[model samples]
Target chain A: MRVELDEPKCVAAGQCVMASPEVFDQREEDGVAILLEERPGDELLDGVREAVAVCPAAALRLVEE
Target chain B: MVVGASAAGLAATETLRREGYGGALTLIGEEPHAPYDRPPLSKQILSGEWSTDRLPLRRSTDLDGLDLDLRLGVAATGLELADRTVVLADGTRVPYDGLIVATGVRPRRLPGDGAHVLRTVDDALALRDRLAPGRRLVVVGAGFLGAEAAAVARGLGCAVTLLEPAPVPLAHAVGEQVGRVLSQAHLDHGVELRTGVTVTAVTEGGVRLADGELVEGDAVLVAVGSLPNTEWLVDCGLAVGDGLICDEYGEAAWGSPRPKAGGVYAAGDVARWYNALFGVPMRIEHRTNAAEQGMAVARNLLRPEARKPFTPVPYFWSDQYDMRVQAYGYLRGHDEVAVVDGDLSGRRFVAAYRTGDRLTGVLAVGMPPKAIRPWRQAIAARAAWHETVPTATPAAGARLDGR
Candidate 1:
């Protein structure tokens, strides 16, 4: 799964990091979400899916391959 | 089936689709519009920075992609748990294999028809059109929604008078110490802040306070909390109180020790589910929790064998003027608060809440998102207050606004 973080929409609420630490992290300067691992392993899929779903800003998108 | 198509209800439907549920699905909502994000209604939408068209939760094509038997503008009247049927206002009884109730909440209004409450898009627009540079705005209840609306009105050039029954606004929710910062924010922004005052009646022109004082204004905005939308479930029989009582798995709770029927679940502002992380029952009205809980309930419904307790590190944020107030974990019932970073006088500050040794919650004001991220981790890990906060942390309190 390829994870993409829409930097503009990220409110820096840091929900993505909480849901999937391995796939996403927030920037220290402004709190925009950064894709820690653009393509995560299958083991981390569940958390990544949650991060995308729960991001209050609707900033995260998952591209399934 | 999912009822009340707001944040939680919409999220549940999306998750069910994403999780490969291809069976006949239904989405019901009382509002005529599709699901939309509400956090921005008091801020951007009210301020005219964003238009109404930008509010939909998803594009129409995306909603259509879900292949839902979408029912909009239809209100749920009652739930027949025994028959697994939901009676609607349109005289239709829709049956579902498994049910998810996300009716959310409605704003509690003052005992009059003259005032406006900001729960829906229409409510925001009506208030927005009335607010002018010289017009007076009398706001009842100094809660987050009230404060945010006051800020917006003040920015729009309206003279705002904020009223609260408590001595300090938000003292109960953010603690008396941290509440000062918010109270000060209103005063600093040229708002007429009145505390320890009550509104006994709403007038066509203004409001009558409990202490025989009449506060006149061009408009009155009532922001005094909300009541869960549980009137429809009066006979559903799945334990209802401040919200729909649910087990740790988000399933509606009934009977003693455990839920008798697991087919029904609740989420969002309407669900008072047990939080395993905090070991207590809580119904959070925040935006993020609503969406997260919806997805959790959906997963638990689809995969009951792997159903895990919905244990979330609750998060909520309110944008007031230039400062953004953010918090993580359960801030309620905290014993002590420490200013881990920033000072009380300044706009930027981070305060940590401790209930005994454990760090129960954390609040940040005007701080960057990165500054508050670690605190969420600390609260989620249930880290001890002393371990994370240095011994020199100052107590969260006020040195200004002598009241």
Candidate 2:
């Protein structure tokens, strides 16, 4: 699975990090999401998908390969 | 069976399906429409930025795939715990093997006409239609909902008067210091903020204050707090205070070990469960908690023997104009509040709420999630205040990024 995040649109609700902390991190200067892993295995797919879904601002997107 | 087909109810249903529960699933909701998210009702939907079609929590195709027995436009009037049956408003009794109550709260209406409350999509659309450009809007409460509505109204070119009875608006929720900062934000945005006064009556022309002062307005938005929908469970023998009392696992707590045969659980704004992280019981009304707790309750229902405690560090966010205020953990009963980063006057800073030496909560306005993420972790870990602080520089290179 591939994760794509639009940092500019992020309101930094922290729902992404709460869901998939291993794959996602927020910038210290701003709360925009920072992708730690662009491509994660099947184990992290569920959390990454949830992070994309729970985003209030719709900042995160997951592209299935 | 799940009562109330909003976020919590939908989440529980989805989780049950995901967890391989093949049993008969029924979702009962009072609203005629399908499950939808409520956060955008006051902001995007009211401001005319987003369409009503975007409000549904799940698409029609996804909901159809779930194969749920959806009973819309019907309300659950009573609960028969002994019989494992739910009494509907239309005098229909629906039996259930396991019950999950997600009946959310309703907006507390003011005792008069000419006032509107935004809780559901219908309420939002009605309020949006009335909020034309150059209309005088008087918001009766200064809570998050009221503040968001006032902001939306102001954005739509309405003259807004945000009236609050407390000395500082949102002081009870976000602490006095942060609340004052937010109150100032509203004033800076040209909102006529009136504090230390109570509304006596809602007149035809406008609202009359306790001191006999009348604030004239074309429209009135009552944003007072909400009350949980727990009247249906009064005879169920479940402990109901502000909401249904439950354990961390979301099981209906009757003070002692269960003598009952059937299972009854609750989530979202309707469930008040003991939070082990905060050492207190709380019924969180936020959207995130509703989703998370609903999933947790579903898992616990499936596996009663291996029940995991649902102890989430409560998080909530509010958008007012260009400012985004986000907070995590319990801020109540905190003695000290320190601005760990940024200047409060600049309207871009992060503050740490502490009870003695332990970190209780973190509030950030315009501060990035990366900066606030560590504080939430510290709160969840129950770390000491000093432990959260990094080096001797204190505020310079003390970012809790790694260690």
- The recovered share of true contacts, given per candidate in order, is 0.85, 0.52
Model 2, runs deviating above 4 Å: A1-11, A22-40, A49-65, B255-259, B389-403
lDDT of 1: 0.87
C-alpha displacement of B128 in model 2, angstroms? 0.7
What is the alpha-carbon lDDT of model 2 when measured against the actual structure? 0.85
**What DockQ does every candidate get?**
0.66, 0.44
What are the Cα lDDT values of the candidates?
0.87, 0.85
Using all chains and alpha carbons, the TM-scores for the candidates as numbered come to 0.93, 0.92
lDDT of 1 by residue, B273-353 (tens): 999888889999999999989999999999999998999999888888888888898988877777878887786888888
Model 2 clash pairs are: A30-B368, A31-B368, A31-B369
